[model samples]
Target: MTSQLSADYKVDHFQKKATVVGLVGAAVFLFAAVAPYIFATDVTSAWIKLFYLISLATTWNLLAGYAGMVSVGQQAYIGLGAYGIFVFNDMGLDPYSSVLVASVAVGIIAFPISYVAFRLRGGYFAIGTWVIAEATRQIVIRFDSLGSGRGRSITTYTEDAIYRNLFTYWVALAIMGLAIVATFYLLRSRLGVALQSIRDNEVAAKSMGIKVSQTKRIVFVVAAMGAAAAGGIICLQGLGVASPNTIFGVNYSAFMIFMVLIGGIGTIEGPIIGAIIYFLMDYYFSQMGLWYMVVLGVLAILIMLFLPRGVWGEISHRFNFKVFPVGHQVQPLFPGIKLKKK
Candidate 1:
């Protein structure tokens, strides 16, 4: 009875924590989506930019932090996802709905490409991914329909302007919420266990009957899909104007990695934390000019050298804090061993 009661208490504790996080996350997004109307024009633009930061960090977290895949070429999909939507909208589809199409399409396209890239390992894999992204950019640049290095935009949404702003806001929020909830749920399932196992030891997991390539490929595709969704929504919010350079810029990749590393790699809470800090920095130092990018580089280097496991990881290890706690713990020292402290 006591053991059962203890387990129930643990479950309840977890539920309460998740509820709190969910409500807080929802509130933050709500404010962001509506901030444009409540504040000065300049302040509104800043908050909207923060949404892109959050979206990128979340997508990067899904990849490296969770699935343990690191690719420097993710901007390839971001560029493609952004550019892809404008094509749909030009053909008379609603720009917002095109975001979903671009996301799924990117996922499908990335799958077979993963087979080619997965052939390499470690540093080679990383470079190969970047090469692919560069090639993708070059291809888009050759197409005049995509503005050929210049940006192109949808003049109108086929669905008309009736509640377009609200629709875009809801869609962006929906994508963020979906990624968060889906990631948490996935991590709770056996798939999550499999992913963690892969992260810990790929060879050992394979030896124990895990389908290594298939799992990695699936995760890679899913991460691409999530990133694509973010990119598409971002393009929509910018009025269906997809600029290849801005969306596919290497800086986008760098920013995402910085946010995840500084926040806490391998944990859900870490990337979001890192992103908020980045947003704050962008807000303050933005007027300071290109020095902002320099600052980001220095900050990332400092965090890595000083707090290797990242902010949240360090905090958790040092004090055993579990703000986003998902693991289990035990009370007694052994299954049937117990002693009185007194």
Candidate 2:
């Protein structure tokens, strides 16, 4: 009787809601794809910034929030991606193509760097990443062809301003879309379960036969690739790297943290919400100079104190719905079924 009753229960990961979200998201993407036709270049160009911001925030959230690896050195890959464009573009690849090539190359580079970074844990791991980033910046500036300490421009790009902005806007949109879609699907996979387990407790995850190191290494490389892609877009949009310092700036990581934390760490929707908020704040208040930064800091502190789970985290906690439901739920096939103990 107990065995028969067990058959009445099943585990479900709501695919329907995810499907609905995916379809709606795709429609939005379709509209965004042709935005340059509907809006001015200036208007669309601003979107390029927002797109990359979302990309950065999403990737960073995946790395730190889901994987529990807080890295402050992601700018290492970002700078590499920016520099890779120059390297490949010089080899005759166009800037757009260079961004793709750069992302792949940075992923390859991140594999070995992960070995070095994985040696540390907790705060040590965080600091180790920062050191690695600084070292990367130093090594990059030593090469004169890549501009030494100064910056260089992409001389091979199309000269038409309209076409250039249009292409850039599309590439930025693509990167942003890829980041969101990849993250959603990745979290829906078995590895996503392992990742959440590792985030909860690394030792316990290992005890459960999860390959904690390998899972983290995979996430690290993927995050690096995402950061690199966004970095490549930054260089392409600007037409060149003005300074390695700016491209590899620690401030970029700080902003990524702000976005992830404010949006809600560990949830996919949180970073997107956070990035939009940060983008709007930056857009309107940037002209305020020091006051702008002060406002940002104060606001972040207030949110952390009040809405510690982040805005989306708090909302989801109360409302009990997920746009991307990656967790499983148990339900009985027969509502009235009751299993008797042996």
Candidate 3:
């Protein structure tokens, strides 16, 4: 009896457009990193806001898009990060150093909270997280050392406004860059594959021996840390104010969900596109009072009706464009030659 051998198969994770897009993206980020040196102070501040928003949205996308963890309590981490800066500053650490410390501390705190939060699933899970965040906010409001309900400022690190703006801008850029890079690598790894699998079908993935709970816990902690880092930068950018109501507000999560949904939920480019759109809308129409919100709501509805998959998702669907290619592409092992199985 004769035996047949199977032909070798190859997979291409990235498309041709990815290389061009990647190079361009890197150049743009480099330019952005030095924006404080090249651009005016107002422009640098605007870019700082953009970067932090992008950071927050990116982490949220990782959690909701890839991990299927629809959390509305990320603002908790943002608040923690912001307040953490105040705590660190009170301990005599510099503002920039405070950003690092606060973000790490929030990340560590998220791991323990995951144990409690992970008990619920689906919509209940989301509500559970929100309740935890509200509880945290209430608890924080009672701490007189943190200014009670009034809030506090990082006073020690306000020596130079110009220097502080520049530092905050740079840190924001770094956080956004790290988030994008880290996410790209994570999606390309085996862990990312498993994460996506879980997002698609939890039961199927669990049956395949994937550690669903553990993997989700990792994602939750990472997302929390990222949002916290953004919060730290945000507090610094706002002249070191750590206002509880503003930083820990539900509005932050609402904005995050809006950006991700409008941009494209499951794709990497979606959040970036969504953030840019959101920033532009806010910058140009923020002065229009209630009309501004009306316009935003109308636009979001239009995108939902027409695009469905989001702006980036629709564009990708139409033109097959993939700036950050995460899907697999299969081709014949031998170009221009077909092999028959024997």
RMSD in Å for all candidates: 4.3, 2.6, 3.2
lDDT of 2 by residue, 268-294 (tens): 999999999999999989999999999
Q: Model 1 — which ten-residue stretch has the worst lDDT?
A: 4-13
Give a tens-digit lDDT track for model 1, residues 62-121.
677766778888888888788878777777777778888888889998998899889988
Report the C-alpha lDDT of model 3 over 1-342, residue by residue, as the tens digit. 754322655667675656766788799888887777888998888888889889999999999999999999998999889888889888999889888888889999999999999999999988888888888889878888888898887778757778888888888998999898889878878889999999999999999999999999999999999999999998988765546888889889988988998999988989999999999888889999999988988988999998999999899888877678776666567666564532
Clashes of 3: 0
Q: Report lDDT (Cα) of residue 301, candidate 2.
A: 99
What local distance difference test score does each model get?
Answer: 0.76, 0.94, 0.88
TM-score of each: 0.85, 0.97, 0.93
Candidate 3: which stretches are off by over 4 Å? 1-7, 15-23, 335-342
- lDDT score at residue 280, model 3, on the 0-100 scale: 88
Clashes of each: 0, 0, 0
Residue 2: error of model 2 in Å?
Answer: 9.6
Clash-forming residue pairs, model 1: none
Which sections of candidate 1 miss by over 4 Å? 1-44, 158-166, 240-243, 330-342
